[model samples]
Each structure stands twice: as structure tokens, then as C-alpha cells.
Target chain A: MAFTKGAGPHQRGLTIGVDIGGTKVAAGVVTPAGRVLARVRTETPHKSKSPKVVEDTIAGVVEELRRDYTVGAVGVGAAGFVDDQRATVLFAPHLAWRNEPLRDALKARLDLPVVVENDANAAAWAEMCAGAGRNADDVIVVNLGTGIGGAVVIGGVLRRGRHGLGGEFGHMTIVPDGHRCECGNRGCWEQYASGNALTREARELTQAESPVARGLAQAVGGDPALITGPLVTELAQKGDRACAELLEDAGTWLGIGLANLAAAFDPELFIIGGGVSEAGDLLLEPARKAFRRTLTGRGYRPEAEIVAAALGNEAGLIGAADLARDALPRWRQGRRQRRLSRSRESRRAF
Target chain B: MAFTKGAGPHQRGLTIGVDIGGTKVAAGVVTPAGRVLARVRTETPHKSKSPKVVEDTIAGVVEELRRDYTVGAVGVGAAGFVDDQRATVLFAPHLAWRNEPLRDALKARLDLPVVVENDANAAAWAEMCAGAGRNADDVIVVNLGTGIGGAVVIGGVLRRGRHGLGGEFGHMTIVPDGHRCECGNRGCWEQYASGNALTREARELTQAESPVARGLAQAVGGDPALITGPLVTELAQKGDRACAELLEDAGTWLGIGLANLAAAFDPELFIIGGGVSEAGDLLLEPARKAFRRTLTGRGYRPEAEIVAAALGNEAGLIGAADLARDALPRWRQGRRQRRLSRSRESRRAF
Candidate 1:
């Protein structure tokens, strides 16, 4: 009802989408059809960061992107809880935001309507509309990078539950007291299934007093600290049995986590993104097998299809842009039209 | 849009929703606004050697309900895998159905259209339309009884994914190598948090080796087998320290599972339904604490409001009736109107 129906496609200026991550901040201008028109990026500072500085950094990126396109509004996809109004970052584990008034602050600086969303939600939206999940209606997008991140899209809309913490798939305890997670919990899903976990396991396995350590030892030299997730991927891809086993271990744990996700949210497709996903089937083949085996009532259930993301690193950029486009006044008009249709269906049911 | 939206409230023609459980088969008629009409229940046949008899028995219940109302379509919510078309029971552990064409078989006997869905999805739908979630536009309904079940609805529509095998929340693993689950998986969410686990722990605690179990041992007459989920509920309510601890333990596990769900679906509301919910805060208070404690980046996110289901056992009836109300020929009037509006939205969005 608040939307204007049939507002033409280019009725207003474009908005900017800013993706704030632990390592970097990316910004982009997106079109209504979900295409990113322009983009810019800047690395995040390591120590003694101020809120004003972060805002300025993000604003600077937006200015660069905005120069090419007349920006109307802005959307920020932060790696933390976004308030219900999509205005504030209540807290961010890896960032400087602590009960920060992110939207208003950014709006004050940029003079635009800034809608903030969870980063996982933004990535999932990108995959659904223009990435790996182009045609799938129900999908769970898992980002397997430093720590595991997740977002669920059910019937074409992001599911950002009551508290905005709906996609914290990494924290689901997979062990009662397995590993000490950065979140101060034991046996959280991320502690075992994430890139950090994988790298840690690789280092441990290579240093083990067993025959499996030999090949890994030769690959990474004598330095256990030298092992990394990419080296393990290289080892596995090079057909190293030891590295393959390590990946299988990670994959098994990954599958175990995914099965839990399957049981919790039965989406049709699972889009695996992030750095670890680049290992492709080496990680996924075992994950697929383990997912099938771990799923509840295995023989009695229809399994969800697991796939890799197509958008790669661009997902965040594209996702942010798409979110920005949707915030534009013209898109609001179109959304109103969709809402009208939903209400029409509602009326008929009544 | 096969449903006829404009049917009268008291119309004789109705739809049947059948909930297939390990213990019983319950069938009822539902109204569009999520009201259950007449209901009938029959004991689930023992794990007999014959599969046809079970279906025959279910058909008998449907037939009896049909005799009372002008039942138009039939919906079966089986506790196992429903195939892609929602036509056949691909597999069921409790029931003997392997590639069973449930829809056609039932349709053949009743001469009606039949749609089969996952029991979890159906139950979730029941809550969404008639139970605790009647007002939510987006909801994640989790059933925490003997086993956990899940259903996700966005914008008031239940999401069934690619096939109907969506919303299997119990199998989502909260712990890695935590406990062996009946699903042949290690450490499924249900392994630690369900009524089964609750009662199991209660029995183990009250065994001969433990002095702390004196309170429960005195009540159950040393018969460990008598420790039912409800008995535990009663003991927990009466301030039995051992039993209270047991419920708290289950609640913590439930919280862990729910946190995972929150991370995945981000539902506006979480409706906790099922038999185990009868214990009220004895279970929920701990769950809330644990959810807050374990949620990733706690205090940095929006959280789902966990509430007990209001509709109770009659949910399936109401949800099924509401679903079928649209499937009938007469409801086609509503479909026609909705299509017009939807097309208009598509036109506008483009």
C-alpha cells in the first residue's frame, strides 16, 4: 500500500551498496535488473579504528562509485546484526561498531536513505537474483571463508528472523565441547567447518607422527606454521592422499553441519561460496556424500542439491548493489505493485 | 493457483489434512482462516509386515471424514520423504512406504485430488495459519517434541523448496560426534534436544549409580522404563531438582538448535510447538538464555521471539483445510483474480 504501482524503471537516481567486511569495504552502483554498474574497494584498518574513520572510508568508496552514476540512496551489508529498521549495527564481532547508529550516521554524511542489512543476507540475495541461485526459489547460501557464514532465502525472499541473527549458521554447536570458538562457545559449527578450522587441521595433520604427515611435510617444508587453506587445496588437487584425507575430514564435518542445516531449513538448493568453495568438488564431492549419509532418514528423504556459487568474489559487491537498487524510490514503487498483488491474493482468500 | 479462493465458509465441500505419526493418524477439515472442523483419529498400526494395510487404514479414516463433509481434496503430511511432485511417499521409516504413490492411491479410492507434504511442513503450516504464528508474515515454526521438525514461511506462504522434503529441523547437527542418532547420523540436533533425549537422560540419571536421582527413583518405583517425557514434565514442574536439571539440559540443547535455526531462516517469529512444549518455561527459560549466550556475536543481532504454539494438536486440521480450500474447482474464482494482480506486478517490476 505504501508503494506506487507502475513507477517507471528509471524514475529516480540510483543508490549505492556498501559491503563492509572484516578485511575490506566494497561499494557498487547497481541497476534494477541486478547488474553492478560501477565499483570501488578499500582495505580495513587494523588497529585503533574510529567510527568516523570507517564512515569516511566507506563514504570515500561511495563517492568514487557515485561519480559514474547519480546516486540516490545507499545500502550497507554489514557482518553483524542490523536493527529491524535496517538502520543500526547493534554489534559486530570483527568490527568497530558497538551499538552504532550506522544508517543515520552514514545518511548524515551522504544525504541519502541508507538501508542496512546483514552481510550474509546480502550475499544470499545476490546469489538468488543474479548468481548461483538464479532460478531456485528456496536456497541456503553458505559462505565458507575465514569463518562460516549463512543466509537463507525461502520462496525468493531473505529470511532475517526476529532478531536479525537468523543466518548465524556457523554458531550452531556441532560438538558439545569440541573446539573453543572465538564466540567463547564450545563445539560451534564454525570451529570445525570453516577455513580457519581447515587450516588448523592441515597444520596439525602435517605435524602428526604418522605416515600421512610425510607428503604434507614435504609440501609445506618443516614449518607447520607455513600450512594454509590454499596449500591444502593445492595438495588435494595435486592428488596428495594426505591432503585429500584432511579435506575429507573437513568435508565430513562440513557435511555434518550441512545436514544439520538441511534438517533445520529444507531448502531446495545450497549455494556454497567463499574462498573454500573454490576447491570445488575436492571439498564438495565428499561433502555431498557425507550430506547424503548424515541427513535424517537418509533413504526416506529428498535431499537438497548442493552447488558452488557462480558469482565468486563479486557476490558481495553485486549483492550490495542489488540491495541498493531496491532501495531506490522507483523500485519502491515497483515493490508496491508486488505488494498489491500479494494483497490481491489475500483478498481473494478472504 | 489450483485453489478456488471464493468458497463459502460453511460450504459442505471441504479438504482433509491427515497427520501421520508413529503413534497415530489424525485427520481433520480446516477452514481458510485456519480453523479445524471435525476430526478423527486412529491408532497407527503396529510395525506390521504389511504396508498396504496401513494405507488402507488411513484411507478408512479419510473415507469416514469424507462421509461427514463434502471433502474436495486430500493432503497427507507423512513423517518421511515425499517425492518431488508431492505424489508419492518416497520413503518413510516409521511407515512402510517406499516409492508409494500416496497421492494417486488415495485419489483412486476417494476420486479426489491429493497433495502430500512433509509432516514438518504441514505442522509448521498448521502453526503459521492457526497456531502461534497466525499473525506473522514471516515465520520459522520448530516442533520440539519426540523429534524436531521445521517449516519456513515468508510473506505468508509456506516454502516447500524444490520438492516437499523441506523443513527437516531435527537432523540439523548441533554437536559433532555428540551422540548417535536413530537417523544413522552422529550428533543430530534431535540427539541432544528432543523429548527422546530428555527422557533418555532422565532415565540414565535415575539409574542405580546416581544418588541425585533419588527423587525420580522414588516416584517411578525404580522402574527406569517408566520415565516418559510427560512424567519428566511433571517432575520438573514439581521442583524435582534432578528432573528440573534434565529439562534445563534439554532446553539448552533446544536453544542451540534454535540458534542455528535463527542463523539460517531469520524468521520474524519462532513458534515452538509439540508435546514437549507442555513444560512451558521449565524448558523455554533455559532455551532463551542459551540462545542468547550461544548466538554468534551476541548483543550484536536481532533475535527471534520464541513462543509456545497456541493452536496445539488441531493445527494440522486447520492447515490442511486451508490448503485444500484453494484446490477445489469452486475456489478457482480466487485464483483468477490473483493471477491478474500478479501479472500486473511483474509488468510493473520490469
Candidate 2:
């Protein structure tokens, strides 16, 4: 419970943030201003069937960060559905976690308060606090990674939904029966708008040996398998027409989905983040145009601004750490209640 | 400023609820419990270019109701967007209300406090207060009428969005490059799952002179132009397989959109209201089945319950009356402030 405090809200002391992604486990000692003072990284035990292996990895990183920073609380952002209580990982598609008590496990290891959050929610919090959505109260953060992930913040509070399963924007069907999603649905927004979509289209072009894809094929040494979302973005940035067109296609899908979001939420702003957003204007310009063309009540309504995320990859860890700090008092109170109940039970046993 | 007050929240005094639709103007003297004690209806001046005609019609209904009951406030539920201030009708698609000062006009005509709200929002408030969504803190009410309209209530408060333009759910795209919508967008959800969609399909079937549509064609005396949404519902309820199948198709599309809504809002319950909901389980059973199959994270997440709306068509007026009563205090305060400012200006002139 030993935590430092600064003059302003954004200048509060340190907390360790652990971001558990499908491929990597990244941790950082983040300040209240969303700055990472210290960091550590390791591969995730993504293939492990036991949840304990993933827990151990997270504990290792926290322990390493805690050695130097006197952190108050730890926040672990995971790539899955975190329960409403922010304690358990209900189910993770990319990891071996099903109803895993992630917060308690990490708290027991670190001897400090801990909170579990959906990675996208964590990223959105970062954007709301210190990144693209800084001044906006009602904002939506869409993470365009391997698959799309998203979060909604309304009236300056994150809406986690009745079951902490809200903001699964990527899974919304854009085209019925079009492209099959990993979630078993067809024509999901992510299937057409995420980094996966960009990489898939680039590979398809190179595989077809289309004359238009010569630049992309040469960049990948004529091997379609070598093509990735980042590689496509790089070529697009270097003025490769085929690669640029692929990004535009994904961006158009992105805009269409955003328009749908506009109809549903009517948010003030949309912050686009993750790997695909690195393409900058190449991805966002088409998205904005499509959003304008597709939005309902287009002429009558004030359109929400679509902007690239400011915090980039560090948003997950930064937001996680900040959220843990914010929840420290509540976590402490819960701990005290649990301890009191335990003592009462011991007395009864006597 | 005269108003009635009752003992309980649900037993508040009388208010007049006016529902302004594209074709009709329905008004009722409603109780706090959402019961309509007295009612009135007239065809809307939908073709008139003058906003004053609609206001005058609403005034006529209020004056008629005043003869029997001493109502406290008046609430108008219009078919399009109401501003966040609850004072203006920003832009209504079905009426001649472009940035119309609806509340002021109604207040002036009736000599009472008035509040204007989106008809869908008003219906949702009614459902949340005394109908299907009673006791649910977070609920989404989707009105499947000529086109879909929706409202979101979270933590028992209606979320009107930053611009009061939220919950335009029908405009959300369900198909890419699919049916063109009157809103100048293609593939809107309403194009697939609303009463208009149902009527259009039924008409198309009969117009094609297909054997399957023989029952429907005969019902309308071989004239497809005479076919309407209610007629189709009546046919389906009477055990017509073709009509039932059409409803099932719309139901499936309804469920897909609901799944998308679940992904975004994660409400505990969904109350399906409006004209199309009159078909009951014939429409809802298929929708529920499709919702279960198409929901994101499927078995891993808690699915929202989809049920037919209570209070039927009267929901819009009932909800409006209740909301007006709730907002009475604030309206009075605003009036007092304006009066004080006016008097002060007169004093300065003297």
C-alpha cells in the first residue's frame, strides 16, 4: 500500500502495467502522465494449456519492475474478456485462460493490489487520458491489430457492459456470409479491416503473381508467406500502388464499420490505434471519406472526428498502470473486508 | 406552474403524451404507471410544408384533453432527432421540422411546460419504467417499425449521446453494397429487418406472380400495391407458410443486427417494440435462434434476452408523458430564469 502522490492528478506515483498479448508479455513502470520509466518484455506462454504458466510469466515481469520502482498497484491487461469485477479472465481466444482469477493470482505473487482489464479497454483509457482522445469525454478507441479490438468511453467512464463483454466492435458482422471469422461468424468487421485483412490481401496479390503486385512481391523476395501487415504498410508508405490500394480497401471497410458505430453510439470522436494505424493518412484518409459518405443523417448531424492514436503500442501498458493506480483504494478496501471475514471464521473455528 | 403530485414515483400526476408520426398524430392523457386514461388521434399533415400546421394539430388535441383532465406537463415524441437541450427538433426526416423550436411552440400553445424527445427514446423510457424492461438497469429497446429506431438505457438513465443523435440503429449497415436506403446509404439494417422490409418482400413476392405468393395475392385482390405490413402479419398469423417464412427471414436479419448490438452495448435485455413486433414469436423465435448462433464469443458470453415490447403502440406516448413529468422541475426553473432575465432587461430600459 506504499504509494507516492504528486500535486496534480496526472502526476501521481508509479504503478506496474503488464500487457499480455497473444505473442508477447510486456510490462512497464508507468507514471500517472502515461510515461513508461522502466520496461521489460518476454514471449507469452501462448501455447501452454495451463493458466499458471501465463500467470508465472506476468509475475516474473512485475517482480522485475517492482525491484526498482515502489509501485502501489499492478494492472494486467490481457487479450480476452475480463469480468465485470476486473478480477478474472473469463475467456481468452489467444491464450489458455478460461475463468482464470488473474487479479488474485497476480496480487498473491506481488503482495500488492491488482486489477485485470481487457487489453482494448486499457488502450482506450490511455488514449482518453493522454493520447488522441485527451479532451473528448465520449470517445471510441479501435485497435486495428492482427484482429480488431475496441472500447467505448462515455461521459468519461468506460462502459464495460452488463457482463464486461461490451466493445467487441470487431466481431460485428459487416457483410452477412461474406468472410468467415475466427469467432465463427462470417463477414466480421475485423475480417475486412484489421492488420490481418491487409496482410491477407497483400499475400493474395503476390500469390496471384499479378503484374500490379510486382513491388510487393520483390519486397517479400517473391514469397507470399513473407508478407505481413507491417511489410504492406511499409511498401504503401514507399509509394507502392498495390500496397496503398490494399490499405485503402481496409480503410474503406474501417470507415464503413465506423459509420455503423456512429449510428449506434454517436460518439464525439474515434481514436484509431494498433499496427495498422501506423500507415497514417494512407489508412485514415479513406476511412474518413467512407465515414462521411456512409454516416446516417450525414447532412444534418455533426460528424465525429476520426484520428490516429497518439500513444501507439505503449497505450496498453500505460493505461493498465494508470487504471490500477486509480483502483488502488477500492482494492485495499476489498482486501480489508476479506481479511476481517477470515479472522471471524478463525474465531468461530476456535 | 400548477402540477399534480402523487405518493410514489410510478404514481405521479397526469401528463399529456403526444406521438407525432409520419402519418398520424396520437395523443393521450397518461398516468404515472404508463396507463392511458384518455386518448385522441388524427392524421398528420405530413404533406404540408408548414411546421405550424403540426403544432396547431397538437394544440387541438391538448385543448380537447384539458376539458377532462388537469394535466401538469405535455410531452411530444417526434419521429426524428431531438436536440440534447430537449427544446428543439434538430431535423426530422418525416416532418417539416428543420431546427424547429418544438418545445417552445408547444409550451406557448398549451400554456404548460413541455419536453420533446425522440419517439424511440420515449418508447424506451416507457419500457424501462413500466413495461418489458422494468427492473433492468441496462436495456436496449429496438423499435422495428417502418424502419428501425432504438434507444439505450444504462444504469437506469437514458443515454442520448453527445448530440442527442444516438441509437439510430436502423441506419447501421448489415449488408455491404446491398439494398439502397432512402437515407442515401446502401445496406442499412432497416433495409433488411424492419416493417418496410417485410412489406417490400411480400409485395415483391406477389408482384412476381409466384405460386408461393398466391395466398397473399388473393388477400390483396391481386394488387401488390394494396399490400401493407399489418396485412402480411395478419396472413402469417393465420397459418400462411409463405408469410411466415418472410417473417422468419426478417427475424434472422433482426437477430444478426441484435448480435452486433450485443457486441457493442452488451445490454442485459433487448425489448423489441413497434409495428413489426405485433407478429410475436413468429418473428422473435427465429430472431432469438439467430442471435444465439451469431453472438460473438457464443457460449463464453451471456446472451441478452430478446422479448416483445409491452404496452404495444401506446408505449411512445406513455413514455413521453412520464419523461415530461420527470423533467417538469427543470423546465420550471428554466422558465423562472428566463422571466427574471426579461424583467431585469425592462428595469434597465426604464
DockQ score of each predicted structure, in the order shown: 0.40, 0.36
lDDT of 2 by residue, A222-267 (tens): 9999999998889889999999999999999999999999998888
Candidate 2, B1-350: lDDT as tens digits: 11334422233367889999889888988876566777899988865569998889999998998888878899999999888778899889888889999999888878899989999999988888778987577789999999999998765667787788899999999998989998899999999999999999999999999999999999989999999999988999999989999999999999999999999888889999999999999999999999999999998878899999988888889888877875566543222112223323432111
Model 1 per-residue lDDT at A221: 74
Residue-wise C-alpha lDDT for candidate 1, range A265-293, written one tens digit per residue: 66678999988888898889989998998
Please list the residue runs of candidate 2 whose C-alpha ends up more than 4 Å from where it truly belongs after superposition.
A1-13, A330-350, B1-12, B330-350
**Alpha carbon lDDT of residue B190, candidate 2?**
99
Error of 1 at A243 (Å): 4.1
Docking class of 1: acceptable
- The alpha-carbon deviation from the true structure for residue A29 of candidate 2, after best TM-score superposition, in angstroms, is 1.7
Top model by TM-score, which number? 2
- Please provide, for model 1 over B158-209, each residue's C-alpha lDDT reduced to its tens digit, 9 standing for 90 to 100: 6565556667777776666667887776777777878999988988888754
